[model samples]
Target: MTSEPITVVLGSASPARLRVLRDAGLDPLVLVSDVDEEAIVDRLADAAPEHVVTALAQAKADAVVETIRGGDDPLFDAARTDGVVLTCDSMLLLDGRLSGKPHSPEVAIEQWHRMRGSTGHLITGHCVTRLHRGEADAATGHQSTSVRFSDVSDTLIERYVATGEPLKVAGAFTLDGLGGWLLDGIDGDPSSVIGISLPLTRRLLTDLDVDIADLWRA
Candidate 1:
């Protein structure tokens, strides 16, 4: 027996996510989703951090599918009619508020001041969608991990933020880059804090009736 070919579409521009997929042995096609993240965040201001990220992940998946369907791309060629789309969103939960991409040096510094020597939840939402013959199937869920920040001096915080690495990353910190030294240790999936969780993504794909091993084979 032979299986049909499948193409996995990553609906995000985050290099962290791309690296995760590559490490998992899947070469996914990148398609940056054009969704208004701030609009959704504002609309769900009262919702839990997990729920908000989940909604954003779903929105990204929807946007990617809509874009591909509107075009006659070979990704949807008759032979590979059923293609998989994966999208994710992450946020930091600090003092009971959802935060994503500080967007400014001041905001990043402010966030770090409050985060120093504190524990926060790094929540990553995952969505996997399968498109076949005009029909779509999807599964969405979230993964949360506890991140503890190092109690660094104010001078160090300023130095780190000045590097401009924290301004565009969720939580204003990362475990795999310049921010690695700023973390004490994470209590859960380290990949979740970076951007996407491999375990979570595997489960989501299973929920959509897709085999995780197939992705690794690519």
Candidate 2:
């Protein structure tokens, strides 16, 4: 590992992901991707959710890596920096179907109704692009968490939908927000369900020869 502490640019705008990184001792700079998520979903209509999610994550990472390579950020100084550009995508797999941002309040309500008392998978794909002197070398890994939901009432689901949280998250819910009460348990890293996985991220950083401790700058 280099004596210099490494910095990271998160290739997403997810507040949850940002919090996860900060809580794990690495502070990341946010750079939202312009990748058309809906278009990617449509293009991979027949693909498995796992593959589709990873593809989207890689696409986002690639986009941001290209953006930085074209010009250095005064803060990041990509041209001389050794850093990581992280991107991730999460989706809930319920009964073999992929679920992401129910979009409409009605859809959120309907999905939550079915999700109650159910067990499903939350898959999050992670991509780490190593920026060495502005050149890119990428590594990727993904995690799947099994989540069990509480058997809540229809009124509760409707009320939660009205809160408008479900409408903006994958699987019409979240583990860190109001949706927490609705979750009975999780079988894997809760952070992955939130947006990113800390343990998995460390492995990816190691794969790219970046020391995870170097990011903490202690």
Q: Highest lDDT: which candidate?
A: 1
- The residue-by-residue lDDT of candidate 2 on 1-218, one tens digit each, is 57666778999988888998888887787788889998998999899888888999999998888777666578767423777899999899998888888989998988887889999999998899998865789998889999999999999999999998888888888999999999999999988999998889899989998878888836
- Candidate 1 ranges with C-alpha deviation above 4 Å: 75-80
lDDT of 1 by residue, 20-109 (tens): 889879888888999999999999988878899999999999999888888777754641367889899999998998889998989999
Task: Look at candidate 1 and tell me the lDDT of residue 10.
Answer: 89
CA lDDT, every prediction?
A: 0.88, 0.87
Residue 154 miss distance in model 2 (angstroms): 1.1
C-alpha RMSD by candidate, in order: 1.6, 1.4
Residue 205 in candidate 2, Cα distance off native in Å: 0.8
